[model samples]
Target: MSWVILIVSGVLEAVWATALGKSEGFTKLWPTVILGVALVASMGGLALAMRDISTGTAYAVWVGIGAALTVAYAMIFGGEPTSIVKVLLLLGLVGCVVGLKLVDTSH
Candidate 1:
């Protein structure tokens, strides 16, 4: 389904994002490779999903998922500081994403 592809793409976006940060300006071979692979897959999936999903909603959802997961991963494993405010903000972003999905009437 398009939604499934879009969600996977969003997750790949996060993977590429995290890999980029770990790549050290492309100096790290493995991370850089991972970034490239994930980036391509993410973009490809996005294009595929766009056939069914509105561009604006799809893009916003992809970005929201990628951003939330990236920051959450950093906070959990990359030594980034975590706070209640940040958690709430992430939850709000997730809620907004879900709301968009629920309100989609283009069936």
Candidate 2:
């Protein structure tokens, strides 16, 4: 399913984002490689999903999922500060992503 691929790509967006951070401006070899691979895969998946989903909806959902997961990952394991407001905002983003899915008219 395109939606499934889109979701996976969204998660990969988080993976590539985290890898890019670890790449340290591409100074690190392994992290840089990971970033390259994840970036391509994520973009490819997004393109595939776009075949079925509207461009705007797909892009918004993809970005929303990626952003929420990225912040969550940073807060949980990267020693980033966490707060109730941050959590609530992330939840709101997720809710909006789901709402987009629910209202999508195209299959």
Candidate 3:
């Protein structure tokens, strides 16, 4: 349950991150509002997940998911380059997140 919340929070983080880029210094009213709402929701979800998960573990998972998803989203929707290196990096990030979860669960 906590992991689910953490994952949702990570997704929200990705959403807001993309929104922030589109916001263009907050000049775009709709994007700016979306970004702000997403940011708050992400943080609130993180706080809820932290009640059950360790801070370090939750934070690492959140950031790893956010970064990997953000890059993937940019590549697919934001016209960013999706080179072999980028794919490899994303895989590496996934591995790191999995490793953390394994170690955390074992403890």
Candidate 4:
């Protein structure tokens, strides 16, 4: 359950990241609001998960998931250039994140 919460928080990190980009320095009302909400929720979830998971492992997994999803979202919708190399890198990030989960000893 902690892992599940952590994963969701990671995804929310992506949401907040995207929202922040869309906020145009917080000038946009909706995106700014979304960013605030998502940011708080994501952090809250991360804190909750940290109660069960080691801090280092939880943080690494959270960051890994967020970073991978953020780049993927940008490539797909934010006019970011996409290439074979970028796709491969994202795959690698995901692989590393999965590796962390598999090797976690606190379960």
List per-candidate RMSD values in Å. 0.6, 0.5, 1.5, 0.7
Worst 10 residues of 3 by lDDT: 98-107
Instruction: In model 4, state the lDDT of residue 35.
Output: 98
**Candidate 1 colliding pairs, count:** 0
lDDT of 2 at 36: 96
Model 1 lDDT at residue 10: 94
Q: Which pairs of residues collide in candidate 2?
A: none
On the 0 to 100 scale, the lDDT of residue 70 in model 1 is: 99
Candidate 2 regions with alpha-carbon error over 4 angstroms: none
Better-scoring candidate (TM-score), 1 or 4? 1
Candidate 3: where is the Cα deviation over 4 Å? Answer: none
Error of 1 at 3 (Å): 0.5
Q: 1-107 in candidate 1: lDDT tens per residue?
A: 88899899999999999999999999999999999999999999999988999999999999999999999999999998999999999999999999888887654
TM-score per candidate, chains pooled: 0.98, 0.99, 0.93, 0.97
Which candidate order results from sorting by TM-score in descending order? Answer: 2, 1, 4, 3
Candidate with better TM-score, 1 vs 3: 1
Clashes of each: 0, 0, 0, 0
Instruction: Tell me, by TM-score, which candidate is best.
Output: 2
Evaluated at residue 82, the lDDT of candidate 3 is: 90
- The digit string of per-residue lDDT tens for model 3 on 4-94 reads 9989999999999999999999999999999999999999999999898899999999999998999999999889999999999899999
| Candidate 4 lDDT, 1-107, residue by residue in tens | 99999999999999999999999999999999999999999999999999988999899999999999999999999999999999999999889988988898886
